[model samples]
Target: MHSDRGGQYCGNVYRQLLHDHQTVRSQSRRGDCYDNAQAESLWSRLKTEVLEVRERPVFADLADAQRSVADYFDYYNHERRHSRIDYQTMYHSHQQLTTLSTLNCPA
Candidate 1:
């Protein structure tokens, strides 16, 4: 997983957790926005296309807002077309990963 050099990410506990999962942690260099541009872009799109368009929300209503945004993310991953991913949904990309799992096997 990729993360900034935040305190939470730099903690020994966090590093151990990732090590347990055999994850190769990639940390962005300090003051390098370009290192995390893709994440920044995604958040920007979500905020502009979803959050900014919504009416002012109450703190008590935060859960509902988060849920709505989560749903939109699902739709974007599974339905929306993107030239970068060759117009395939993220869901489709995941399916491609397990295509070999569907190979002929005895019942």
Candidate 2:
């Protein structure tokens, strides 16, 4: 997984967790903040569109937060139309790309 060089990500416990899961850790080079801009933008949208939409703006627990985020991502990938991809949902665009790639591959 990719993340910034924050203390939490740099901690031994976090590194061990990634290692145990066999996930590679990728971090932006020092002094280069643009590397993570896309992820940061997604997080900004998630907080604004999901968390701030509620009056309380806080989840009851970890599971609730996870479920809410999962639901938002489901809507984002399958239901929401994005202008950047000719107004297609992300899932639709991804499927189209996958189909195109499969068709173009050599037999």
For all the candidates, what are their Cα RMSDs to the real structure? 5.4, 2.0
Tens-place lDDT digits, model 2, residues 1-107: 99999999999999999999999999998999999986887788788998888877488889999999999989888998878889999999999999999999999
How does candidate 1 score on lDDT?
A: 0.82
Off by over 4 Å in 2: none
Best by lDDT: 2
Best by TM-score: 2
Clash-forming residue pairs, model 1:
none
What would the per-residue lDDT of candidate 1 be over residues 18-101, giving only the tens digit for each residue?
Answer: 999999999999998799887877788788878787776622477886788798889878897767778898789778767756
Note the Cα lDDT for every prediction shown: 0.82, 0.91
